[model samples]
Target: MKMKCILCAAGALAMCTATAFANPAKESEKTEFNRHWFMQLQGGASYTLGEGSFGKLVSPAAALSAGYQFSPVWGLRFGLSGWQSKGAWVSPENVYQYKYLQGNVEATLDLANLFGRFNPVRTVNPYLFAGVGVNGAFDNDEANALNDKGYTLGNIWSGSKAFVAGRLGAGVNFRLSDCVLLGVEVNTNMLSDKYNSKKAGNLDWQFNALAGLTFRFGKNHKKPQPAAVVAAPVQTTPPAEKPRTPAVQEAAPVAAEKPAVAEKPAPLREDIFFRIGSAQVRDAEKAKIAALAEYLKANPDANVEVTGYADAVTGSNAFNLKISRQRAESVAAALKAAGIAAGRIRVNGKGDTVQPFPGVEKNRVSICIAK
Candidate 1:
């Protein structure tokens, strides 16, 4: 029966692995190995049920477990447990009490977040585990026949030594924080029948309910930043000088009418500039704002557009838009204070709709003027 159980467990594991590989959607999930390692401490009560030539015994036990999660989806646990129960045999006086101490190690696979249809916060995870280890037992004085019928008993009734054990369990994990997790689980350990010979060599079963806190370790758990893109520089060639025109020399030396003069185009100017989410202007920009005010005074015909922007970092499009508009209004107010006509200044906020730089901080704001 134990061999058959082992075979079935192996088959299930194979099927799970195959299914995981077959589904593309499952494969696309970011299995961030962030919580690769952890430790858990647990204490709980358990009921042991068993039957043998000696009798049947049901007992209560306590357990502690510590484990490491290989990923968000897989973990391995090692545990120690102890329990005591009562039993009866042929002779009415054959009643006795049994006690056991054991240890187990098992590998677990998370199923809830993996197989469940709905997961909002994505913090709750459930898993199933199965593995084999070892167990040791030491019977109580009564069961050891140390004082049988009020007299010293012989060694014919000693408890069995160490024996092989196997376990299967399920558990749930809740992420309480970035580095901490809370877990609750239930498991059953099957100790080989021969471990307690005095109890007719029947299989020993232990059930445990445990809760623990796990602490994750390592640098891989840190949040990742997006990669940056760099732009290549443009190349240009030098201009060649033109040969003197002979037609100009042959033409009558017309009075060199005052050399036709050319006027330089005006430099770009901003009506206003200020920070996002705040009305304060940056100190470095004060000189630029003064220069803009002087230029606007010289060219009264030019109209200014004070535009404001907010990055997508804040997470609310509507709120960002409102804030951006307020910022633009603030800048327009500043321009009005600088003597620019209310009618010559126009204000608008684009929020994140007109991002000039991809994932860059400098593209968050702007101010423009047109003639």
Candidate 2:
């Protein structure tokens, strides 16, 4: 049963190692591997498996680790740990208590980050590790007495007071913010037979579990935002007194005649855009739509012509044309909902036409022109 438990922890560590290298972040996030540093402090419980009372087998454990992360997915860490271990050795019924300290080096893999890097809302990750190091008991009267009784601190695993130990473990970390992480890990340590003041003649192991925080030190750069969409012009005239036919029917363009004195030309175009293949306007664009409705209310004779277009890159011409029409009608519906008279509104679809704008992003647009 003891051997079986050690083997299971080792297997889990190995499996996580394979998965971390095999999977990568999603395409959308473009997660990159970079260099960084971190410090961690953790405290938890230790349990020894042999001679002590099942009740007395519980002990305290704590560790301080420093790591260099080659990337979010890979890191190397070194740590010092101290703990109390009490258990029976040589037989299932014998119980003893001992204090030990160990220093180890480990390779850590963030398995969750490897598989879920593209998740924009990613906040949690599971990690795996394996390490090798040295362990020793306190150099006190109790330890010296054990050494005299052939209770060597180091047996085949060590020739001096210090002995070798190997560990395999798994952990989970939750990212609390940009530079702070909280994690919990459990490790199994394989030890020399005689180190616990007993001559078990067989390998013995213990388990330590710790929860802690990692302080990350690095900068993550941000991508640039796209340029704003420019609205296209439709009319040369300003607000005029003469009312033309409602734009729903064909309305002739009214040329601006300079009055005795001229002022700035009123805006002729109001554009509202949508995501590719979507007819829905975003929240930011709704106020612009409402403003157009307000303008129409102020100039009772004014009418609007709404034209919608779809980008050519994302969909087929037939599909683009269909969605473009839907987008135009959606804008016209919003206008009516904002209390503009339906009869004065004219809606048109211009699908997949080479856009007036520079890129595909700006091309997924709908323009509202005052007539």
Candidate 3:
């Protein structure tokens, strides 16, 4: 008997777990890999400190970077940066001079909400990237002057020379629209060797902040279409007979009939959407919400069920289920504010279990009629 009771309890527990997993509300969808080409232009200021003919200088710098992120979470970036800095000569005579144009290329990895670890807020993502590449340096006018004076300036390089370099930085990427992104990042580059130019000697670090825009090209994930609207039926009234009917009334009075009233059809349901992995609705969904509010006002007896759904991007099955539920609850709250009766509405979140669409936007809300 004891063994039988234990088995029964285990079975009950399993059933409860299955029930929880079965009805996941939709809001927990994860962001997918972004495979597209992107470009950015950034300009900022940097202070250089290292071994160089010129001691130290602070200068304004600009960079134009273009790259492709094979997935939403990773990519490669190549940028050309140039700066002019004034440095004090440490040796013979104390003279300040400007030197070298620098450029490089590196791979970047995006860490913001990667792997569906967290809910996405705005489309903006903060990322930390590190990669190894090459930095090129060219001799400036200062190097030319030293050469003319017959000073033994090391390597008197005039064009670009490649040196091993790496970069570390943090940046935020904001999606302006479906295919455009605005990004800003600040990074510091460390070169393997010091730069030697006529004006400066050991400049070894390149640091700058960059801001630019990127255009994305690829297939867009499918999104739910707006609910279709159905108009109400119209009623017609019969025209009244003239007073001459009084003479005919002497024979037989005709009965007057009421006008036929048209029945109003049910209002269209509203659709709710969210940022990838987040419960917050995007601004684009405002119009849909307004339409929903109007529908609720017109149909007082209608009951609504808001079911949230998430994409298969992240989280354990249980966690995704919980996220989906929260998303539904959020929509329910919005409806309540729009005069929907609390008792007439139901809310639920279904994690990534059932996807309405195959892509990232699959994280969404479903509104069902209960009346």
Candidate 4:
């Protein structure tokens, strides 16, 4: 039956091996496992419940385990645990001493990873574990010791040897660093009725509470990424200079023609529209602003007015007023960037009353006029 149980457990583990790494992948997540194989050393208190004295059942227990984590969620461990428990039955007459040892094959489950782990603040993982193993008794002082104490106990081995042990436990581990974990675990062990060399209706039990550190080892595998390549810059040659023309004799200067009358300043109005609900100016609209800047640069004395508005259909009065102000500020900022004198530009943030376009979309505009 022990062999059958072991085979069944092995089979179940094989089936779940693939599922260990089934966590959903994320793009921004950069954390990775540095090592896979790990060893743990733990020490804690152990207790036993059987046909022994009930008082002071506590004893010292310790274990050393080695394991490989298949993924963040699942893994396997093998360990040997030593337990020393001193107690007796409730009657206080049948006192028993126990020295127990066990070697186990345990399955580990990381509960945090199994559930959604999106919260950044939660870094600790609580886990569940179960295992089956061989149990043996080292101190066989059952019958002889009870007789020496003048207690006519039922015929039973005070110190027995060689039985099966099964255990289930829960623990919480805090990831101290990428390669280190600190945790505490409590396991309860179950065994055959004759485990303590005494006849009992139910299986005997042992409880272990341990604190440990897991030291990880192995080469870390990194997620694959494509390499980036840069192109070399192209070089160009300068154009050759043309030969100078022969100098010509200077001609007599003629009287300058009467100064031409200054032409009337022409008013240039440009309307730039933005996408609905967006304060960002598109690429196409940038060209228009650039052209206006160039024209103003050519005509130094020219002054400009920037009026911004939003469509009433798209936004509330207060929102439209705010957006309109943003639109004017954006256009004014652009003009200032073009080397235009700040004093020559007048910015006005008006209500959504200027619907110059055929569609409501057209009303979301900033109008610039240079005179």
Candidate 5:
């Protein structure tokens, strides 16, 4: 029942975290591996299995680790864990303390970033790690003294002993800030039987429970802003009044009236913005197309040119050119749907070669000019 309660609490925490940080603005972020290095320090207690009671074998432990995240889901770290360890003997019933240290290179897999959407602001992250290294045990003064008294402590060594060790662990890190995290982990290490100054004829196990802080040093992925367009404001013309002929002029011989000159309409321009990586016209932008169509119909002599562009940060030159053409086609389709004749509309794709806007996101846009 206690285990079930813990599981339930964990599930609740995950749900709350996901709901609270469901930011749509993070969708455009692209991961950059160069900015994901981190360092961690932890302190806790360790328990080694032997012939004594469980409480007697507990000792203090601490670790320091530095790692780099190659991707959102994978990382590699080198760490050192050390402090005091306890060992025991069976026949004489003795528990002896020793100083120990382990250095290992571990590979870490972040399950949260792997399975769920990657969010740099995510509150809870869980990961697993495995490693192999060497463990050194030394300073067994209590056991050495007992051995001097002729008490049989099997395979006693006065000097430090080294053994090959393997480790497996799982941990959860809670984000405390943009650059810091609080974490907890538990792991078991397997070492040769000789590491404990005993001949158990099998591998020995050491378990550690730790909690600490991790400092993340690199930058997170930068999310691009939504595309935007700057358009010339529409100008309205006031009504023109008709001229009245002079009644007195009727008596005189009618002079040939000069022909009135036709006035040219002002040029109209508009812009349509798109989300990154997409060429579809949004519902809100449909009104711009309609307005342009009306302007075109009012001045039948006018023709429109539509040009589309893509941002430079997103894709290859060829890919950008293709998508930019698609964007222009999308706008041309919207214009045709608004009853503008296809023959009067011209479309062009500039890709990233011609950036009309200063911001990268603003380049993902299509501009329309009617003249």
Candidate 6:
């Protein structure tokens, strides 16, 4: 039965792997997993190995654990799990229960992240774990009753017994949000023969089927980006260079009457940048919006064109387009709040279809041009 269960888990892992590969992942998500701490609480049923029917050996179980994820693929945790475990013999038709607590330090492997692209938003993650622990069994009154009845149970425990245990398990985790997850797991534990006080001649086996919630602490992504640098408005045309003086005196005598040319003032322009994956206008960017509003107010005839853009490197085309539109709308709203009439402001989002700036970070911006 244990071998069959192992095979079933292996088959499920293979199917998950196939599904991961079937989907297209252009780039891996850059979610920082280091230094994140998580806690889990679980409750379920436990089954112990015995000669009696399967239904006779089932009992209650629960567990609590806390751990740290070292990376996307690996983590370590310490957990305490156990409750009632039953031992039974069919020949005498006797069944007895005992309480036990097992504490284990286990290592975890995230199978989905290990086999496929690491996506922070991916909803489901399957994992495998193994560990070693010590089990403390006590409150064996039922076992004592069986022993007193001459049931031939070898060396019944009087008070308590402590023995080594080993565990192996697999589970699936459903991400509920940034810091919470729902999970289900099934694990088998191997313990010393004396744990059940039945002298079963071989090691005892205990199985747990559990469901739980995990709460994690720490940000999944790295630090929020710093404020973008605001570049000074650029001139559309270069300044005229000073003409060189004539080396010979004859050049002064040849001055001709020419039409006077009037130079045009440079158009006002400013850029408001945004942090990665965010559309909210920062306080620093607000100043630029106010300045742009002032320019519009100073020249009633001049209108400002606000165009928003997003980087091509981060999100999907649809996601990029959505955020780009949001970025533009946010800037336009800010301008309106600053007393700039909506009719005078023209706003549009280019998404990643156009790159107005050179760098990826610089592309996440809204350019305002007054003409």
Say which candidate scores most in lDDT. 6
- What's the lDDT for residue 319 in model 3? 74
Choose the strongest candidate by TM-score: 6
Regions more than 4 Å wrong, model 5: 1-34, 224-371
Clashes of 3: 27
lDDT of 4 by residue, 1-371 (tens): 31332344445444443343343435215433333788889998876764443345567999999998887668899999887865465565455566877899999987756664322223366678998989877775754576566664443565456888888977766667545778777787898776655556778777777889977674222222223222233344444454555665887555555554555456667788888877677888988888789889878888889888876555556888888878878888888988888998998877565554544677788888887
What's the best-to-worst order under lDDT? Answer: 6, 5, 2, 4, 3, 1
**The 10-residue segment with the lowest total lDDT in model 2:** 219-228
Point out where model 2 deviates above 4 Å: 1-31, 89-94, 118-121, 139-160, 220-371
Model 1: weakest 10-residue lDDT segment is: 219-228
lDDT of 2 by residue, 50-163 (tens): 665545667899999999977666799999997787755343243456678899999997776665553322455668889898887653344444546664544322223566
User: After superposition, which runs of candidate 1 have C-alpha atoms over 4 Å from their true positions?
Assistant: 1-35, 51-64, 82-101, 117-120, 146-160, 218-228, 234-371
TM-score, every prediction:
0.48, 0.49, 0.44, 0.50, 0.56, 0.62
Off by over 4 Å in 3: 1-34, 50-56, 83-87, 91-103, 115-123, 144-160, 198-203, 218-371
Error at 306, model 5, angstroms: 27
lDDT string, candidate 1, 1-371, tens digits: 32343345446544554443343443224223344565666665554443323224434566666778665566787877767644444444454666677777888886743564322234555678998866666665565563555433322245546668788876666667655778766677776544433344457565566677766554223212234323333334444444554565466764444543444335455534445455566666667566666777887777777777765553256876876787777667766788888898788888755554455355355555544
Please report, as a residue range, the 10-residue window in candidate 4 with the lowest summed lDDT.
222-231
Q: Residues 218-267, candidate 5, lDDT per residue (tens digit)?
A: 55443343444455576657545556667793487767766755667777
The TM-score obtained by model 3 is 0.44
Backbone clash tally for model 5? 0
lDDT of each: 0.58, 0.71, 0.59, 0.69, 0.80, 0.81
Question: Which order, best to worst by TM-score?
Answer: 6, 5, 4, 2, 1, 3
lDDT of 6 by residue, 47-157 (tens): 887788777788999999999888888999999998899988677698889899999999999887788876666677888899999999899999898788878788578
Q: Locate the minimum summed-lDDT window of 10 residues in model 6.
A: 219-228
